[model samples]
Target: MSLDRRLATPALTTLLVVLIGLVTGCARIPTDGAVRDGTTELEQASEIGFIPAGPTPGASPDAIVQGFLTNAQAGPTSAASFAAAQEYLTPAAWRAWDRYVRVLVLDGDPQLVPEDLEEGATSTTVTGSAVVVATVDERGVYTEETDPSTVPVTFALTKRADGEWRISQLENGLMITTGFFSQAFHLTRLYFPTPDLAWWVPDVRWFPRQTWRTDATSEILAGPPEWLADSTTTVIPEGTSLAIDAVTVTDDGTIDVSLTSTITQATADQRALAVAQLEATLVEGEGRDVELSDGTSPLPVPDNAVISTPQTRGDALAVSDGALYRVVGQSLVDLEDAPSLDGLDPTALATGPGDRPIVVRDGSDRILRLSGTGVPDVVMTGRDLVPPSVDRFESVWSARGNTLLVGLASGGVQTLDVDWLDTRTVRSVRVSPEGARVAIVSSGPSGRLVHVAGIQRDADSVPTGLSTPVQVGASVDQVDVAVWQEDTVLALIGAEQDGDRAVFVAGVGGQAGTGGLARVLTGVTEPTWVTASVGSGAMLVLDGDDTLHARQTSSLWPPVAEGVDLVAYPG
Candidate 1:
């Protein structure tokens, strides 16, 4: 939960530090070793998936990665040797490895040199294991090769599994630009299980130009054309690693990613970068790719945007053409004519009048009565009905005919009896398109307040349902009522607690729709609220500055509507 909050909000860059100094400890590859091509050997081993010896037999995976790194630096340049080393890569990790190796070693410019490499470093404590650190000598290459300089490099590595060791991080020691160069190392983390590859002295530092050739089966190793292994998924729990099959940005603002990689914590973190980078790009319009780190794109998002509630069938009838109607259904069978408050604000919608009286609440915390005669009479208006403790009207919805429920930011429910225009304190209330029901969110003194569909027979009696409060994502902190598809009740949940906000949709059915929470969209800045239009697949999210921001549910890309003024509904 805490981690989700950190990721959702604006935060510092994630750093990697292990691979930085991995080679420093054992600087030289074994002197007498032959550069045997282990390519065929690794390919054969990878055919059925790299299965190392079971529990009591082989060395741990980390030890294996270390062995490979040491061997690579020794003298072997065989494709087969590198293939043996490829066992530690994830699908995505492999791409990062391939990119790095091609750029820094095989096709390197040849002017860069390491000044030093650090070993025996410690990082954050992991689950039962500790994170380790390392450092490497950094080199700077002039474009024209006239002058070159050496820079210090540092890295952070996490010690995972008893046998599974991974080059969990990499970074520059200096913090002048991004302040923490660790993010650079995370690039290959999504692909490589261990950071082990030979270093080539480059004359100048420039982007590597080797292109990877991948099919459903064949994969590239440290550089392009170096076929490493063939597999659809790389499982690294034991001897396996993650691998990336393909990554491309479509013309329609969609990022299509194909993964043949392992699914592990390391892989997840690595994939998060790719996903974040893509999502950030969508959030940022044309010409601006989100580049968070030197290696990853930092996505720029506005501080906030307004979130919208879904428009439902019952609500749809009332909101079609911005006109109003009275809807009643045993199961959406009957809807009748209702009086329209043509000049009211969009927020003033709760219910309208027909043969059955409609209960309505407004921004003023007052319960107004709407009748078939097109007259809106005040039923209970003022502090007497709203109570002095209530702050502001966050939302208002109909529980049933002539019964209205009002939600306040101060955390209290107000039930208004429209027949006599009286008020009462209700434990809980849920307003569904079918009817209104009272519900209990939690049994103990502390829990999320739940509202469910129910009924009211008499002014003093209320019948509740079995439904519970909708369960939201772990990090969700707030929600607004939304009606979508007529039957589904949705609540737009704010997933950030630290002023960083993204919106999610939760069905307001039984148990608060625990099974129906969907991650509709993310990467919005200061998203105070959200609402969705069912017909157009569009959504409106409010920013912290009280602006109505609109976007489509299908694309969720940027060029979204910003700062829409909220005003009275025009007649």
Candidate 2:
């Protein structure tokens, strides 16, 4: 990415023979005989290094250039491998190259085009064009830039005393070509403390698998990224950090997280937050426990603390005939007689996250909450308001033509200043379960696009701004967003290529379109609404006829409910 003039082409003819110095490398080749039963040879080999190979002495300029690029592998797991890469560079140029700055990951083989060599010139230009898929920085931060990146690399060369080509001048950092980014890095979610300190916001980050466990915990200690800086914080003591360099997960699945003594004498709430952060960041499989220590005593995660998870889910709750119903075994059981009932006219229901039904009263724009007591208590009261979308932080977020209102579960309202959504006509907003992201389905000059962003919150979990907005399905015309599948499944009501209304799934953070959906259910003419349960993985759709059909991961879906208009699931 650095295009400084000093890095442009200069000289290299005399050293052509040196880059031709392909050194002999040693390796125990893995054959069928090396693998017996369940044992594999690769399992025993260190994944972070090479045996140190270089282009042979007789190789051409293009081959040496390709070899230098494809073989240099300095990154999160192998920052020291650049030493081996130094074998290809002249001693002076190697000393000047800063390998820790940025690592460019290319898509496929780099096209090496040699320019017309000048008469009696030692150096000529070689223009390289390679698609850049992503880049990893020194901090281990990665960004996927799938645009094709082309760079004119200058390789000044000299014939060393041994009479061979050695790269005398080159740019800093390693250039990893070929589609190797996926193999070197993995999608990892680093947990950051939400405003309430009762839950965590999953900031999806990428880490090299070789150093993932260690780097993951360190990332947590470093706190949330810039987008989440306002909405999330660290519960670890202010000065506390990882005393050790790495977090070790034993073969038995026990995670040992060691921190400094700053947390040893911390408050009960602080200690509990520390444990929650560690467990969420370290534990991988079910029932695998996390052990935190300050290098002295074993500290366990507190049992009294509550991690925010919605108890009353939207998929299980339904409404019909001006009455409330809980769906059980495909039956709509009335809940009007449950508790302290009164005059409750449900006009519009807010979906996602809550232990009760949050609806806009028939004649009032005020939001009403009916839970344990069943007595309708006004939570958010205002005029000319739209139905609220219950966010994961136990807060309600509603936007009336870009004028957004965010109310907490406690009892207060904060109208945030969001000028970004003004250009587009805001239709509906749904927050993710992590309470850090907001999924908005809005219409603009380009038609309806799905935008997902981080919900920046104050210390009290009040909405401030929606940051890092990325329009999902930008190329697809989406009508409405049904629900989110935790971090993966994204359900939307859109038209298929043949012009038939259908439900589509774009697996967020992964694949796209029907390729991400488990089964294709088409011919739902004029499909309007969709919802999927986070707990059950059950998906339901409502067509123009108001008929409802259910779909899980399987192809077959029985009619689950009828006479239902609006539907949703917990965020």
Candidate 3:
């Protein structure tokens, strides 16, 4: 989602009044001075101007703890708010605290219980508890907790020499309410190029809205995250850094990025690729351009420099009654000039690179590749193979039992060894359109697990293995299928608890509620298969009754075609 900085009118007005009061209280009036007239100036206030209140003099222990928690919510976005929050803590405590360690998102306000101490006591402890819904690490990666539970928030307050109660000890990180987090931070994606530079892969991150542009650019230069490092590559030269501390946006929406002289060592192609990556990461609205410099000379971008966004063909592919057809405008038309599946008894189908159809035979469990000469060849065989997923590299992915196999278009098959998939039965496997990542659904002792990981490949872009998997949709207990709706969104066919099978939208980097398993379609009668087109944002699902349903804007899934066995978009 994009940045949402809107605040309620009434709330904004109230905050303005509070700020005015604070400013007036700190100003000193000169009553004896003569009235002198000068030019009057008024500056407009920023829409996001809201300074959190500082600690009150002689406040109680619980009051100080509560105030600290409230003010810390704005610490990530505003330096004034962070300074105000430090007022509630002792000198030693402020030094000991590390605000970037972790961010605990709470369901609501925490419960603070202060200890009853004698009137002369100098120190006391306050116990706090809140139900944590999610957590963000120092790198701003958000992970939704599978189960929400009450977590302790303890604080130790001591009376100082000035007869004021200040927090002396607390946790290293800050605790914030979900409402505050939603307003202060935004979920953004950093783009990186694949090994071959054919497509852009997204790496999700959370950043404070006030400094998102600078943060995003710095992260792009720092390289992709560990989980995605092997699959993606960067063109920026090593040791390249921002010449200045911040990235500046001009009045006309042009982004000016000045880099260190290390960028001078890059080749022309490398410089063009670097510019493409910066533009993709920082350009948000129309008419915005990213200009680069080395603090002296301007770096020119190539005229044909282009970074590819993952997109699929407009029409979808489906198999019905042992025949392959192209879905066009609610009608199934025979695929012309393509190999006929007349006698193959195809049950499932997928389109590889260049619209080549890969079919899975009904009873033989063999994957067949249809040639241009109307001949079908068995590429791989298994006891019970899932549907095939083709990547941009012309490699096909499918799983059987706990083993993941890739059928190379150049030659034989190779079995991948995924350490994290130990003993888990592979239910479904789908390669992303960018060919840099793969999504897998499996079942193990912990029930259904949906994971997305970067695809590791060799210098020739051949499948080698997968990076460490990151679990997605942790709350989904019965997931049967998972498809990529976009680079960072997944369409999952699963149910929570004992609910019926339906369509859920899951964000790759964790969403707001229920561990990213937000139900998009309810009352879907046993959705067995699903596919989505990234270009059109259209989704199709195959129900148990052999009816193909398409998603509409009104959240309704109307049947598009009947007696459909499988559906898929070009991968």
Best candidate per lDDT, number?
3
CA lDDT scores, all candidates in order: 0.29, 0.58, 0.76
lDDT of 3 by residue, 52-155 (tens): 78777888999888778766776777887789889999999999999878888766568888999897999999997888877878777887667667998899
Tell me how candidate 3 scores on lDDT.
Answer: 0.76
* Cα lDDT for residue 347, candidate 2: 52
- What ordering of candidates by TM-score runs from best to worst? 3, 2, 1
lDDT of each residue in 395-456, candidate 2, tens digit only: 77766656677767777877766666777766667677667777777777767777667777
Please identify which of the two predictions, 2 or 3, would achieve the higher TM-score against the true structure.
3
Q: How well is each residue in 1-571 modelled by candidate 1, as lDDT tens digits?
A: 0111112211111111122111112222221211111111111111011112211224443343333343222112223334544444333444454223211111111122222323543222111111111111231110111112333333223334443444344321211111111112111111211111111100111111111112111221221111112101122223212234443344664443333322233343444433342332223346433222212332233332221221223221233334444222211122356566565433343331112234444445465545567667554554323211110122233333224544332334556453321232222233332222222221122323223322332232232212222232222333333333222334343434354455555433211111112334554566654444333344455566654444533324343323332211100
Mind sharing the TM-score for model 3? 0.86
Q: Is candidate 2 or candidate 3 better by lDDT?
A: 3
- Which regions of candidate 3 fall more than 4 Å away from where they truly are? 1-51, 56-58, 160-163, 337-339, 371-374, 511-520
What is the clash count for each candidate, in the order shown? 84, 14, 0
Looking at model 2, which ten-residue stretch has the lowest summed lDDT? 32-41
* Model 1: lowest-lDDT 10 consecutive positions: 194-203
